[model samples]
Target: MRIPRIYSAGDLAENTSAELDAAASNHVGKVLRMKPGQSLILFNGSGVDYTATITCVTKKHVIASIESATEIPSESPLATHIGQVMSRGDRMDYMIQKSTELGATEITPLTSERCEVKLKGDREEKRVKQWQQIAISAAEQCGRSKVPLIHPITSVDDWVDNKPEDSLGLVLHHRTTQQLTGIDKPQRVCLLIGPEGGLSEAEIESAINKQFIATTFGPRVFRTETAPVAALSVLQWLWGDFNR
Candidate 1:
């Protein structure tokens, strides 16, 4: 039988016992109904998975003894950072989950001119925490040893101001004459996607002025949530780790 894998926030070391967090304990004890002496794997997003067996099970807690660890390398050779404008409802959540599964190294939720999802104060913090959790769970399910970092929500203008010079930066805009596959080999890339309503003309112009190249994915228009995943897939097929 295949052992169930769980992602925890605790420190893991070989020949040591680590207390499973309450959430994981509940999952193993109640959800999975894993009894003592059963085997499972644990990962702390440290690029290694700890092989462990259940040592004790009680009403209040569950403990596992680590047997050994298998070192896992990072997924992608060419890193892609997706800078997506926040969309409404579950749109952003779906984007983050699928992007993590597709091997996006980093994700930034940008608040752009067309963003309809307004978050203020505590709500912003709550949403960021939720999105980060989604990313972690997606990594765990998708067999990624390390979870992608979900950056704190920021404005589009601020993000454009701090973009790195060495990375290839491209924005998804229909007006652009260039296709995504036309780009040459680049070690790292940053993808900028607009919100549901799409980026205003002025916003696109401003991004172009700041040296962000625009690229399209053929003639059909894709939704805000779907655009990043399509672009990432094409990018991976053309010049990234997917070719391996």
Candidate 2:
């Protein structure tokens, strides 16, 4: 059987015991019903995987003995940060999960003029936490040692203004005929995907003014949630780990 990989928030060191966090503990003890001596993999988003053996299991806690640490170089060479306008319902959840699996270094929930989702105060905090968990789960399943950072929701204008200076920025829109073929390879990339109703002409122009190249995958337009998956896949194949 395949050994389960669990994400633990605490520090993990070789030959040391690690107390799995409450969520991980519940997964191992209550959900999986794993017993002592069962082997598992633990990661703390440190780019290292800890080989561990279950040592204790209680109703609310699961402790594991770290056997060894192995560096897992699963990150893509081309760092991709996705700024996605929040979609309604499970669409946003699906985007976060797929973006994590696709080697997104960071994801920011963007609020665009056409965005249908409105989250504020406690609801916003709760949603960010939930989206982060989704990224963690995707990392666990996809053998990624590092979980992508999920930023709190921000407006499109604010997100564009705050992009890393060194990163190449690309905004996806159907109106643009620009493609990724002629663009020079970049060490880091920031991709902005608009909402279901799409970004306004002024919003797209604003991003373009901020040095964001308006680009498209093809003549066809993808849904807000699906664009990240397609764009990231092509990016990985062209400039990331896919060729390696």
Candidate 3:
């Protein structure tokens, strides 16, 4: 059987016994019903995976003894940072999950004039934490040792101001004339995908002025959640490990 992969925030070292967090414990003990003595892979997002043996499994928690650690070589050489407009409900969740699987190094939830989701204060913190967990789960499922960093929610204008002017930035606008094919090779790329209502004209102009190229994905228009996946897939094929 394929060994189960679990993520924990605790420090992991060979022969050290670590208690799984409540969420992970519930998964191993209740969901998977894994018993003591079964082997599983544990990752702490430190770019290494630990071979662990279940020492105890109880209703409240699961404890495992780390056997050994191996560095994972799955990270992409071409890093991509996604500045996605805040989407509604589970759409944002889905975006975070798939983006992590596609090897996004960083993800920032961008709020624009067209954003329908209003988040602030404690609620926003909780949401960001939830999204970060989704990213962690995606990393585990996709065999990625390092979980992508989930940045806090910010305004699109602020995001543009922070990014360098010379970097290869792109805004996925349907009316754009440029395609991804002829662009010069960049070590890193930052992409912005608007919400369901799309970016306002002023927002698009602002991004364009800040060195964000207006790029399109052929003729058909993709949904906000689906756009990132399509863009990332093609990017991977062209510049990331998908070539292997």
Candidate 4:
């Protein structure tokens, strides 16, 4: 059987044993129904996954012992950061989850001129945490050793202006004549995408003024959540590890 892989924050070392955290312990015990002697994989976003076997199980805790460590090098050489305008409900969750699986190095939630959802204080924190969990789960399942960074939410203009100098940046819009394949490869890229209502013409212009090139996906219009996944897939296939 394929051993299930899980993300854990505990230190993993040869001959070391640690109790699983409450969340992971509950999962291993209740959800997976794992027991002593069964093997599983664990990663802590520390660049390697531990091959571990269950050593103990109880209602209070679940413990695993590391048998070996394996290096997982699935990351792409070219770093890609996506600045996505936040959408409503599960739509934003879906976008974040799939993008994490597709090897986006960083994600920044943006409040744009056309954005519909408004978040402040604790509610915003909660949403970010939820999205972060989705990203963590995606990394585990997709066999990625490094978890993508979910940046704090910020305004669209601020995000664009503060982007790293050497990074190539692109904004998706219907008006742009440029295509993804036409651009030269850079060490890093920041992809800016709009929300459900899409970017206002002025917002698109602001991105352009900040040196972000406008690009189009195709003739058809895509929902905010769907566009990022499709675009990232194409990008990875063309310039990342997906073609392998």
Best by TM-score: 2
Candidate 4 positional error at 106, Å: 1.2
Q: Residue 159 deviation, candidate 3, in Å?
A: 1.1
Write down the TM-score for model 2: 0.99
For all candidates in order, the CA lDDT equals 0.87, 0.94, 0.92, 0.88
Q: 95-135, model 1: which lDDT tens digit per residue? A: 99999988999999999888898888999999998999899
lDDT of 3 by residue, 46-65 (tens): 99999999999888989999
List residue ranges in candidate 4 displaced over 4 A.
none
- Compared with the true structure, the alpha-carbon lDDT of candidate 4 equals 0.88
Span of 10 residues, lowest total lDDT, candidate 2: 174-183
lDDT of 3: 0.92
Q: Cα lDDT of model 1 overall?
A: 0.87
Candidate 2 local accuracy as lDDT?
0.94
Reference-based TM-score, model 3 = 0.95
List ranges where model 1 is wrong by over 4 Å: none
> Considering TM-score, which of the candidate structures 1 and 2 is the better prediction for this target?
2
